[model samples]
Target: MTPPPPSTGQPGPATRRTVLRALAALPASALALGAAPGLLTTATAAAPARGYATRYTVVPFLDSSDAGVSVYQSDDATDFRLIKAAAYTPPANRVRDASVLKHTDGRYYLTYTTHTWQDTSTTIGFARSTDLVNWTFLYDYTVPIMNLSRAWAPEWFVDGDGSVNVLVSCSTTADEWTFTPYRLKAADSALTSWSAPVALSGIGANHIDTFVVRAGSTYHAFTKNETTKYIEYATAAALTGPYTFRGTGDWAGWGGTREGPALVQLDNGAWRIFFDGYGDGSYYYSDSYDTFATWSAPAKLPAVSGTVRHFTVLKETVTGGPTLPTGVTRSFRSANYTTRYWQEQSALVNLPVVGSASTTAEKQAATFTIVAGLADSGGCSFRNAAGNYLRHYDFRARFDAHDGTSTFAADATFVLRAGASSGSVRLESYNYPGRYLRHYDYQLRVDAADGTDLFRQDSSFAAVTAWA
Candidate 1:
């Protein structure tokens, strides 16, 4: 089946037939990667500490404009939703290809391209944030490059020695794409001062969006080969060095016309690389279990694909945050699909459009009493109209009479999280910490979080007036 047009970051117009058709046509490889089809869910029996976040915050630019900088967050890298839109638009400058880093001073800092590709720029923009949401403009630190035509895609890299640096793509020729990576070191802890620009060796001109991460004694670099548009991999012993580039063309199977490669390490120690498939106007992320030696085929970033342009993600652990409320009879409204609500059908949960035309029975099916968790007090359980509870059976969400078993209690209970989107909430399975209560093809299920934009929005719900 032909896939539907990409979502416009709003409630989609997918009907049941289109959804089922799309599901039926999903590739086996996609199914294997949890991209949707039959159940590919995993229920690992372990939970993280309550009220702390091992969070992944994505800072992506919608475009090279004043309203471009936006912030998104996810529990499992696969599911991301917006935390703040236009979180910070730099004063009098366009924000593009932005990178974020939590500095040692307990503040978040941003580095980005100050102008569009059509304009000549010599400075990279900067900003500081106490929380990831609000921002204060710092300064547009000029790149110390002679006859610089543009300084683009400034990525933040903290060295092994605890020094901060920005890897920027520099070009001296106007209207030409020929560019090379340069290292700009922060001269002071305030990040207001920087050292002279030093050209990186071996990675010659025409390479851009260079993101570097040091593992052990080697620095692994992922840069876009401008000519081929394939994200190439390179390694060096030093920060600025004679690097070796491999997997030149189609080496990793992430097709060409990709750029702005950013990487973040998962809690499980695996790596995920995100890039823009500009040729098709999509954002794709690929995972590597054994580092960059191998990679899973790139998958679209659900709600974010076709929306955000070049971006980067920052992973951090948040502690002592807010907790979920109990004893509230509330109805859950889908974040992305505003008119939809969580409703029960034949003892199974689904996200269906709940509106005034529906009968009283239809409203009750969409209502649930949020109560203290049967398994863990820190979490919550959804109890429905007939006194049955919502639980995951074989990874599928179903409403059933409580069996009074420990496993049933655990399966029914979920840890509440501040939603990826503002004023929303995410339900993390109590037994499978990283897994969440989300809808796949409109059917409710407990699935492992894979770090997709779709997963992020599907798992996020807003507590609203009870439908009953």
Candidate 2:
């Protein structure tokens, strides 16, 4: 977007029942979110995520009006294509709210819930696909007694124990809407055959779909709550009965309503959850610690730039350890300079203010803050001047963090006029006690020093506050 305004630099959690609230609106969101060859099941993708390498591939979608599914792909996550000019006609009135799961067994699964022709009974069902193209329907029924017929947005997750779990938001025979998150254990691949659906805690009314996953030893479920969606984490050392509901949150912000919760674990051991917002158009984004972990603050997906289709970390088993990117401090450039430090990385783009005095009459300036870093242990001091410490001011934006979530950076524009001097600005990391948390201070804190902040305050301030 306009080259992001020349990189002036800088930037910036949730809970449970908060979870139930989130699940409440998921079904309504999924109808708009899925239904290709199969369902568009989202995983509890990992946290500390790295951008995807494989470009966006064409995935199919069912158009209710066309009575069939359509296919499209956008190498770039935002744009879509009309590769196959056709739609998939389902057995029912409209096969809405579909979620596809690309499982660990290398097999893909699709699940969805919709009503019949007369628009009376709605049922949750499953299908299977190997190449993500053709799907084989596994199950479809009327509603309760195998009766309520008001179910919507169905999600399926296979846990570490090979237990197939299904969660959905449903309404009662009285038309009372509620989150009917369920778990079903499959004795065999014949998905049609399953144990009785065991419903978990009912969260408010209106919740209709849910996506879940497992990390460590617990299960993490996210759903569309009211007004603002939320993330809920539950633990079932065993797949049945006593599912302990211990986590809840709306970390993704309460102002802009969000829905369609999806979770995944990151390569770095953290977990991230995503959802779509209603009324408001930003995507909900945030993360947690472990399977039964609480969420941090959630960030909004940018509207100016089309939202990312979906993000998944491609993990590969490697020998030894990670080879981090090389860091460079001394950087000179054609008006744009970026470097990596211990906590964050930032760029410096020269914004020329023509006229006034002359080229030699100008001087450079900079400022900023960090989200999660070393905490209490922060300091800033740059080279006073190349020749001597001028009558210039000593300025800096102090920051010390320990949590990696909501990391931030901010900088200002430097004004260098004639008779100005050349000197470098720097900030020092005083040894921060306590591990604080994993990866707390491991990222690069871009523009943490005054040299970077000297660019623009409001832009950096806005970016820093963008997530939290």
Candidate 3:
């Protein structure tokens, strides 16, 4: 839907009806992502451990005079602590709609609109950082369009082939303008060279504040319909796209007001969409289980220390060993032999086998914390409560607390496969992909699958909380 008259600064009733009608006419299957229609609900699941300390860093626009990029970080998305109040100052001294992207090369790039509000300018500010704290302003570019009066809300996405593309809202008219999303490609890692602007299609007319995120194999673009002041989305298979329009959803239940949409995937695998409630001077968010078809009622995030607007959230990876989840320690109980538990014997972590236990002390030996193994390759190593790791020696499962050698790490790592039931997971040794961790006749060994029902049952184990 095209935006309402530009100079009015408000949409009339007819414009609102047009937007509502457009939203209602969207295909139900497209809107629900193939799920049954229902009110927005939140999904509850165990927060997936990052296998390391992962940080969520936010970059928000402060204000006009001091409208520098502000940095805030949180381990969990629920609690944000300010890191740097003014991480970088724009060359124009006025900035809004700040977006940050961490490139594959380990450098960070920040882009924003150099002008605030209706005062149009062709300049879009740019900066880069090796460390998120200190940013060096690389130089701003004026869109090549001759009549370009505004360049606002510049956001960026990195392609699979390592190319960086910047998307920005631009308008040619100074007063009565229709803002549209356009793209620019950076030629190098430093973002010093850029290609000319190319208009994005399939997002409808007069859209702004574009943000794109990948869910599974599809790329979803979320943007504000500047005319209707409602948030809508489209999906594309590739980074540069002939994007297909999805459906529109109201932000925080507010119609014709919410703008500058941003998104973040939480540790619990829930997707959150954040929008600026400019009328209330607060940022509101909604959670979605699927890719953004339906949404939970918009709720305000914990208030930041200062006035913030039009921001971006980025997940930062910290270098270190795996940081095990606080309460993920579990015991593996054999499915075939219900009373038997996997245990590691001796302080050296040798002789790992399934054994019957009658007392609490005996059962404690079976408890283990699954940790990321061997260079944090997403495979896991079980660390017994005795501080020893379950590793394979000579193709036989054993315990080895002191095997700091690469061989031990490689042998110890196992890729976990989800079983048919809840709280059930199967372990496949990294060294032997076709083989699994199974106990044959109560002896722990890594054996090849025989394609028998009994073999599958023997390979599976129920992960239960350790005995009290």
Candidate 4:
């Protein structure tokens, strides 16, 4: 069946009796996890310990050919690998826009839209799974509204007080469609009982695929502006109410065609928004340090194996802190001047230089690593690739081979300061409070903060390994 367009919206009218019969007729063996490993089996692969917050995003998607729900899992958010193909087989011939929510009790509830554009009586389907691989289909339900032709992209957000909020895109008209977001609240896991659907105001008409995420004290709602066909966002202090529209932009990579936006926060404190390129069968993402005020350019993610549409991401809580980069040597690339590297040359009388390197091997000579203490601690020394330590002579920074003397320890220590650029860090002299390691006319030196954009960018350096 074709996908329903904005105009001529329709709803599926599969009865509760039919749904109950289908569930009862299904064999127990079909739902049981037998000798073979289940699709949603717990992952045993050990992830690299980077001391960063680890998150597992479980994506529920539609396998259009099989007319079923499949699942994928991601540790890094950007790279989603298939976990269970066709984890939940729908009773209908087609289903789309799947969202999986992990309940407080650790079970997962998946919701999706059943029937494609061909059916007028579209319904929202439900399934529950203790382990994501195996799903038991619950009864299908429709919004208790007159002439509600379509219900699409149902996503759930559990509030702090334990109430569940499900945001759905729906329309009531026949010839002209005015798709809008509506909220349905449920207090218990059954999900059979829900509050009457209430229209989410502030955002204009023709908006759909509503996904909300809470950061700090504020809640942000990401929705697709169907009239404009671009993903936009709104924010509110409370989950239900007065959300201020925060302008429209194409932060989800490809313009016009991108929709079904989802969000996840990385352990490094960066936020990412994932959007589906529905026409291209790809997913695009953008990064932001600020809370949706600004965003990085959209980049494409690795393609999922099969045809999929409209999914959600969930971050799993990780034990322990982020894996710190200890004893790891990294080359420093200048943020302001991309081609420049941090270098030390004897020809300039041991002064550190920030200049272009001619070859790949020469760039290695400019690399340095933290020694003695944690990289973030001010007690760390910068040891270059040549096995020489960076130290200061009379407050002037220079690289010198260790002479097995205590003086080397005192002069070499520096503190890492957060840089103006994202993912960049600045080195501040341990002895000087306001002074930072900065490039002065391509020469590396310790200087006081100039408080200029150029100076901040010049002082900032992104640490990278050879293979990163």
Candidate 5:
């Protein structure tokens, strides 16, 4: 491992809470974009074209009682729910401000702070995982900064040149609560070695939790302003550069006391930024349709607000992964609303009444081949008579041709859980763990189980004799 260059400085003493909170509210120093965890490939490719299927894996810091990171998955970025509560907890370290990257070798790498806000340290921890749930300790790396009070909030940044880097906020003086952004470049693709730390220029001191993304030739950085307590914006021509702050002190319209600004591009070419509202203990996100110039009002992340802190989100595009079996046909009859049956018309899946007077086409539309799940064979995929698959797009169930992508496979596959009612089975979404295939207003859609009898009955279906 390459030793980071040494620097001269002197230390002072201060409480960890003040230093960490001040650093959290610090301003932008520098930024860069890195691959989000859960991606199976190594290529740092650009975002997929609009309409392509994608999955977003979110890692956030849970409250103090949970002392580790939690993992969440979402189809639409807005509705993120817990996938694992204890995704990665460092052995003797706190997983504060954890950043994830799926390396080229197809393993998930996590870089996080080694201590809580009460202790000062110059080292950050690293871990690796094959599956996002299980992680193995890699090593603890000490930043080579002399008299460093704290090295906090390490975030992975992949430059446009394909070089991997980590942006860390370092405070030299202990009592003053001053922090400046510094970065260490990965010396190799394995990320086991790193170059010396260098301070980011133009983005002066007192900024923390800086997250960056690239759009064309421009680099956009969203960082917190420690002094003003608002997330600010800056841009640079190069990755490690003279970043000029374009917006500061409420320029983005989000109120103060926000930190940990993380950005990810949506499948529709739009941009979304997630930030920590430490003051109110809520997590909020805002969308930008026209780059970073204008943003919608911040909205609390449903079910995620007040639950997590200082997190990062990784979006991975999947193709040709996850498969299903094609075999016997079956029909689904609604358990609660026995008169209605799962039917397809004009490519949409819905619950409609089917009786002896129903036509042959109606009967055929209601019947489907119960194939082994496209994503997980343990589950099942429904195939229509015309060779189309019953899949959920934008959370709505429909009959669409197989796209041979992992997203399609996951959307199409439904795990057969024991029915909410006796002798009935509820179709749970393979990708979204707690969500099930249910009918809302007679339209088939995947919704989270709300623990109500109506929801249980709506999601439960009985396998009747094939109508076709």
Candidate 6:
């Protein structure tokens, strides 16, 4: 279908048509991953279709200057309704950013961070709301955050260890000065008693929007680089220490700014991040104030699967040759003798000799080799443009999944053929070293979404010796 004009100018809620289109496309085959049995809605045998609204009026709060710690009931862009605003008054330390979460007890926790004056404190605060709107402040930690940039990006995740932690980025200095990344743990949801703000090592010194998510037993923290104009990020295995920096190359320039990354690992082996960039705001849009005047895409919040009737999709592909069976002898992407690594890719590929190839087929096989390394590869993930689904391959990228465990950061990588025949091809780490192959299969899935061209293999083989 001729995709509707890219979402522009419209705000508040998504139009009804948009909603229907997106809803219709939710793949019923997707098996819910990580989430409990009923966390996601199952595709009905047959169901209704609706249009996406033009304006999702569900604004957590009514504010043009960016309200903080809010929730708005919305489906797409057109029809939106805000049920409540932040119970805490917005004084000199106006709102910064927020996240709305639901726990096992049925209590909704609104964990968000505030930007203070003396320093950008990574403060954690919350309120309870039965209906996303109308919040009641249960905790206020905005004050006394002078040590760890005061906690700027305060996102909450239930670690795999079964403990809840507030994943926040820090800027050691004040917001007016400089900043860095840090993590503060909560004994439970009790904001009053925190495990103390601990500085995450490995990150050079300055990073913005520090958030972490859980994947199995490890943790993946997402961060931004203030040192360079181009986008950059870092990853770490644990929550509070030793993060490795992957420079500009991995900075996912997909969106102009590439900062403030929020991630969710959906079922079907997809890891998606909701980030802010140019088109959505003035700071990043090429036409707005301080405009870069380049083809840079704007930094705007991506409309989640819940907000769109339909989503825009951009596809990529790698060919036999740059000119197809002609130009560029850059070696078959999977033809491996040395070692290879990629994040996201398109369609698929034909396996040529890669590792220890003696014959045509041997040298052509795209065998994936995986090693149990630190999950700190600043890799990338593929997107389904239409759905809120993503496939994250980077091990070290910090994720704030609200899931507790030591297994969220980085796992292992599996090497085999292309498609997961019988849909068995998948990777995920949940802690325990017992299931190495399945735990890190996605590690070998390099290159972002490209047109199909890969070998389908079984779990027994890490190095593809044959093709299907």
Model 4 is weakest, by summed lDDT over 10 consecutive residues, at 32-41
User: For residues 146-243, what per-residue lDDT tens digits would candidate 1 score against the true structure?
Assistant: 88777877888887678888888777754334677888888999999999988789877767677777777887778776556578888888988789
Between candidates 3 and 6, the one scoring higher on lDDT is: 3
What's the true lDDT of residue 447 in model 1?
76
Where is model 5 poorest over a 10-residue stretch in terms of lDDT?
32-41
Q: Tens-digit lDDT track for model 6 on 1-468?
A: 011112223453222222223434444222100000000111111101111111122222222333443344422111123344444344335444555555556665565544433333545556666544555667667534454444543555565555666555544343322455545566654445677656667754445555555454444555555434234445556666586665454444454334444443321123334443322332221111111112223323322222211111111111211111111112323222123322123322222223443544433222222222223221111212221112222322111232222233322211111223431222222111111122123333222111112321211122222221
Q: What digit string (tens of lDDT, one per residue) describes model 5 on residues 1-468?
A: 111111112332232223444555444332211111110111232323222335678777765442678888764465575888887877886767778887778998888877765567678889999978888889999989888767877888777667888888877644325677787899988898999988777776766667778788877777776666678888888766689999988987888867778887754345778877767777887767577887767777767776666667777865522222348777889988898999998999889999889999999999998887777665678889889999887778999999888768877877655555776777766655456789899989988665456777888888878899
Alpha carbon lDDT at 408, candidate 1 = 84
TM per candidate comes to 0.65, 0.49, 0.59, 0.60, 0.66, 0.44
Candidate models: Cα lDDT each: 0.72, 0.35, 0.62, 0.59, 0.71, 0.34
Candidate 6 yields a Cα-based lDDT of 0.34
Instruction: Please identify model 1 stretches exceeding 4 Å from their true place.
Output: 1-48, 64-68, 320-468
RMSD of model 6 against the true structure: 19.7
Segments of candidate 3 deviating more than 4 angstroms: 1-51, 63-66, 174-176, 249-256, 320-468
Writing each residue's lDDT as its tens digit, candidate 4 over 182-249 gives: 77888456777788888776754566666777765676887776545577778877766578887676
Backbone clash count for every predicted candidate, in the order shown: 7, 95, 3, 16, 9, 144
Model 6 spans > 4 angstroms off: 1-63, 66-70, 73-93, 115-123, 142-149, 172-176, 189-191, 229-233, 246-251, 278-468
Question: Best to worst by lDDT, what's the order?
Answer: 1, 5, 3, 4, 2, 6
Better of 5 and 6 by TM-score: 5
For 1-468, candidate 3 gives per-residue lDDT tens digits of: 111111103432221123334445554321210000000112222232334444677777653333577788754453456789788886655656677888767888888777654355678888889888998887878878768777766777665555778877667664324566777888876777889878777764466667777665677787776555677778887655678877765533545566677777754345777777654656766666555666666656654622565677776545532233333787777766777767665532222344444466666767778777652355577876667777776556877675577656767776554433455556666544335788776767777554445666777788777752
lDDT of 4: 0.59
